[model samples]
Target: MKRSYFSAPYAVWMVVFTIFPIVFVGLYAITTRRADGNDLYTGLANIGNIFGNEGTYMKVLWRSLSLALQCTAICLLLGYPCAYFLASKDFAKHKTLYVLILLPMWMNFLLRTYASMGLLERNGVINSIVTALGFKRLELIGTQGAVLYGMVYNYLPFMILPIHTVLKKMDQRVIEAAQDLGANPVRVFYKVTLPLSIPGIISGITMVFMPSVTTFAISGLLGSGNFMLIGDVIETQFMSANNWNFGSALSLFMTVLILISIGLLNRMDKSKTGNGGGKW
Candidate 1:
């Protein structure tokens, strides 16, 4: 009874902070408002508008998914080696190196996005360097590549930390055994280290992918509002258009999409574990 009483506060807090907002948004999504500022109960009207309007929302969603996947792939490709080096080596000042990796995350996200803009613009340092080297000036800002670069830069730490954690926890004897059995370093990594680090890969992928899909600040700051990612769409609908119903509907759709993707990934992970005969 005492424990139950103690847990009540947390349960009430969850209801107030989490569940209530969801319920409120859902209710708002299904209501209609007149020009006179009176809201009327209009079931499914907002949802219909979202799907029936030439699928603009869906296109934005797909763009967000594509950007997120690209960012995750880049992070994995770049972070794997860095994480492996950090985890496998006994370098001087190793802790300092890890701290440096984490330092970017300590800064404000908006500031980081703006900083990326400063470095990628027409008169930016990158352009100046390219011109100095006698290469044509590249349009780094307001391009898909710029958006992707921002996403990767912002989320790389998330990818690295998870992979590093797994690598650090790995048993060194496993590698030694493979080497003792005449296995090359590459072969040993593929057969032993790579297989053992699936959890970290999964963790990193989820960590980077989820946030990248929902990010608006980077796209706004770096992409110069030219890229219409789903997060930006949601912001526009709610804040700019003042269409709470449509915004709520889009938000709900995005939330559902993310939940479904997470569910599918978890199922795939379970299937892989079952087939591989390995436990996470």
Candidate 2:
């Protein structure tokens, strides 16, 4: 079979779905719907409104970015240790552990987040335990903390799996060579294992950070709609506010931001390679 046969389907899919939607959004973003239901070309008007001095929507963008960075940092901190342990040769049950890590992710993302709501609700399991222990019932839901927890819980596996795969496939001989050279366990990990796992770390960071920025459902369910992320603002513009032009503008901005993030991360990965990240 010709390679064109395999490539044809993907090309069609991109044209119909990806390319078409972007073109549609771009048109809507650059035009304004007049009171007569006619869309007029407005040039940079919509884009300006988003980043203009009076554009308070910029705050929502910053908040989403801040939360995404925090979520990525937290996932890296928690996932690296777990990945390190799982990749250890002495961890005989690593396969079973891998399955456990993947089990929750198999469920619908919305359903998993909804289930978390039950745990964080006022009369929910966690608050019940607090009350039983004679402590005051903590306000678990409808807060920034709840939203952050949801982001971390939902995305942590993405961080772990990549790092685990990288660590597991790493050359054991390189690690042993470091040990033989009188490098302690900590030194070997810092200088060798960690550097070798940079690709996976970068993959995990991008994966978690991208979705975290655009997630509106988690904040809706967990934050009780109190937290307005850029995603939520875009959703409101398109759905409730009947402002397609502005919504499309926000969507375009975010798409550009995400693309820039991926480009920067790729550069970082290349720089790590160029600098011989794993060198002793």
On lDDT, the candidate that comes out on top is: 2
Candidate 2: where are CA atoms >4 Å away?
275-280
How many steric overlaps are in each model, in order?
A: 0, 0
For model 1, how does the per-residue alpha-carbon lDDT over 1-280 read when each residue is reduced to its tens digit?
3577888999999999999999989988889777999988999888888776788877888889999999999999999899888887676666888999999999998898888898999999899999999999999999988999999999999999988888888888989999999999899999999987777777788889899999897898889988989899889988989988888988888888889988887777666554432222
List lDDT for all candidates, in order.
0.87, 0.92
RMSD of each: 2.7, 2.6
Question: In model 1, where do residues sit more than 4 Å from their true spots?
Answer: 1-9, 274-280
Residue pairs with backbone overlap in model 1 = none
lDDT by residue for model 2 over 1-280, one digit each (tens)? Answer: 5577888999999999999999999999999999999999999899999987566798889989999999999999999999989989999999999899999989998998889999999999899999999999999899999999999999999999888888888899999999999999999989998888998898889989999999898999999999999999999999999999999999999999999999999799889865333311
Task: Work out the TM-score per prediction.
Answer: 0.90, 0.96
Query: Best candidate, TM-score-wise?
Result: 2
